[model samples]
Target: MHDALLSALSTVNDPELHRDLVSLGMIERAELLSGVAHVKVNLTTPACPLKGRIEADVRAAVLEVPGVQDVQVTFGATVRQAAQPALPGVKHVVLIGSGKGGVGKSSVAVNLAASLARDGARVGLLDADVYGPSVAHMMGQGAARVTANEQRKMQPIEAHGLRFLSMANLSPAGQALVWRGPMLHSAIQQFIKDAAWGELDYLIVDLPPGTGDVQLSLTQTVQVTGAVIVTTPQDVALIDAARAIDMFRKASVPVLGIVENMSYFVAPDTGHTYDLFGRGGSRKLGEQYPLLGEVPLNVEVRQDADQGIPAVLAHPETAAAQALIQVARNLAGQVSVRALSQSLADLPDQLTVV
Candidate 1:
């Protein structure tokens, strides 16, 4: 009966990774308890958006086995760590950037990180924008102070169930950080190296605009998982986005995808939609990258940001919040595909049929 269950489970594949769970080693254990089938499954990431589909498919597959009166399915997740040794206990590091400011890049980063953390992933947010650090304020920790742990490493501030570190917390309010290139580089390096970031599935770095010193220093310091570019539908923003994409390409870092922010707006009273930025700006990228999502303009998002609550958590049913969740899911899917692709490539000469 156990062997039959294995054979049936082999036909069920991960909807996003497009690989059989059994072959991918996602099935931790499978057995028969009298007339019931008990199965344990491990997901690649806690932020997997398709777990429901996977579960339903798994149950359907197990029922095909004879002598199984009922099926009991249980799930757990273990994120795969990269080969990089930069952040000791971090599994993946994702940089959220844009070509210019005022495009809601920070909001996107905050909400995405929050969404992933809500999905049970151990998440950390690092505000790498020294000159204009707003992650602290957006996270409702503007008055919070940074402290050192017993090991003398800077500790991350806990807020809304997410661990975050920011220069805004490290420095005083209304203080201007006039840092030169070398200073900026050193600060970035310390943020990546000197912080006491415990075990985490994803560390999201909200980077400043443009392709400058901080970006260079970060690439030199560690092996990043990839980068997500945020832009509006405006021509100028798209042009700058082109340069940013080229910069990442020159540095040999994969450009995961692009995010279109403020794509459109709908009047709450009249329920009429308006293309506030423009139309089809992402389509101009010429199929070079995936359009992660189009986040609509909503007054509620701004209100939520000020209140230090991410849209995905504060207003999950809103259009803006749903769009942000989609972006997080898409980003997670891409990371899983890349991580599992290497594992698939390194498969042994002989197959191990469980």
Candidate 2:
């Protein structure tokens, strides 16, 4: 009976991973008693967007086994650590980058980290935009008092369910950072190593606009999981976004996907949706990379962000907030898929565990 149940489940493939559950080691337990089957399906991440569909597939597949009159299914998740050569205490380092400014890259970074933390993962937010750091302000950290532990490691500020750090907080009031190569390099290295980031599942870095030294510095500093490009649905923005994608490719960093921000607007009075920044600009890029989501322009999101509250937490039911949350989940799924693929790459070719 156990063999029969395992055989049935081996035929069930993960929707996103494209492999059987048994082979992937997602079936934590499978038991048979009194002609009823009991099973548990452990997913890659708690924020899996297709969890409902996977659960349904499990039920359908197990029900097909003869003599199993009933089946009970439960779900749990464990985010896979990035294929090593990864950073110490950090499972994934995701960069939220943009081609030019004014596209809300920092906003996406903050919300993405918050969304993941809300889903029960230890998350960190690193503002690597040395020239223009806004994470301290966006997360409502006005007088950020960064302290050092006994080992003299800088401790991250806690905000919005994330361990946050930013150059803005470390610098004095109303002063510009005129530091060049050596100074910039030292700062990034300290942020990556000297900081006391303990066992984070995701470290979302908000990179400054364009493909510049900071981007190169980050790639050289650590093994990055991937990058997510944020752009508006306009020709100018899309052109720069394409350049950003090319830069990641050149750096040997995976381009996770593209997110079209300020994609459209809707009137509160008449319920009319208008394409404020032109339409379908991301379609061309979508051919090469996944279009994670199209986030609408909302005055409330702007107001909430200014007030140091992420939209995903401030207004969960709002369209813009929901879109961002969905984008976050999609990003998590992509990270898990990439990690699993890399791990499989190092294993024997003939994986017959299932």
Candidate 3:
């Protein structure tokens, strides 16, 4: 019965991953008794949007097996962690930040990480937004826990081809974190030093809005490659964006560029564009820095995020997803340029005979 059940389950696949659950190590156990089969499916995160679909698929597959009169599908999650490194092997650490709240900084961070992973780059996202970590929900791991390995190092959870660590995974859902500056600093430090990030091409840090303890802790903890400031095309957002830029400059972290999210909204019925938040605000800010790219205000982006699948992965053909991909490409190019420049700077000078 177990063999038949396992074989049946092999036919069921994760919709997002497009791979058989058995092969993906999602099926934890399958047992049968008195013509009834009980199956346990372990997901990467607890808040998986496709949980119903996955359960239905598994049940349908199991019911097809001979002698399986009843099928009971159970769900659980085991969030994995990486081993701690003496020195992080990440090539570049990009901080996604905003000066004020409600500017969609976390959304950009999640999509940027997804986009980079889609482009075949090894990416990791760290949600340093301790007060309100949204990466877990956005990535569908809201109920996932961060477990430590035998070495006492925290392991990052994996989703959408990216390894991520977030405060949401550490705390229960809707739990408020009340910590002072020193405590906040220690938590951020542990996230950087104790989490096993492995070797990553890019580790995207999603910082909480504003230039606060987390930002200071990150700068003091790790050598950030640069910062990607996110802002809407509005004066209020732009004002805070400037403060964020100044914060990065004061910390000596390069401002890679600025991304103008919610630049405009397009009517689906009439195919008309509306600059709901006003226009050229990011370009105005671009006078002092590079304008990385603009992401349109699209409903699909929000829906995909709620579904725990980033737009870049869920609907790559869409305009919004493509815009994000372009931003990722531009960001990668900037990183490459900086890396090459640093490599040259590290080289010993060769004296020439006069």
Give Cα-based local distance difference scores for all models: 0.88, 0.88, 0.83
Segments in model 3 whose C-alpha atoms lie over 4 Å from true places:
1-86, 344-354
Query: How well does model 2 score by local distance difference test?
Result: 0.88
Q: In model 1, which regions exceed 4 Å deviation?
A: 348-354
lDDT of model 1, residue 186: 89
Quick one: ranking by lDDT, best first? Answer: 2, 1, 3
Candidates' RMSD to native: 1.8, 1.8, 15.4
- Expressed as tens digits, the lDDT of each residue in 1-354 for candidate 2 is 777788888888888888888878888878888988998888998888788888888889889998999999998888899867458888999999999999988888888888888887889999999999888887889578688988999999998778988988898867899988788888999999899998888899999999988899999999999999999999999999999999999999999999999999999899999998897798799999988898999988888889998988999899998999899999999998889996665545333443
Model 1's TM-score against the true structure? 0.95
Q: Mark the regions of model 2 whose C-alpha exceeds 4 Å error after superposition.
A: 33-36, 345-354
Give each model a TM-score.
Answer: 0.95, 0.95, 0.73
Q: Which lDDT tens digits does candidate 3 get at residues 1-354?
A: 777788888888777555577766678889888988999998644434466889999999999999889998898754222122224577678899999988788988999899878756778999999999889889988888999988899999999999999988888788899899999999998998998888887889999999999999999888787899999999999999999999999999889889999988889999999999997799998988778789999899999889899989999988888888878767765664454443344433332111
Structure candidate 1, residue pairs in collision:
none
Stronger candidate by lDDT (1 vs 3): 1
Worst 10 residues of 2 by lDDT: 345-354
* lDDT value, residue 19 of candidate 2: 85
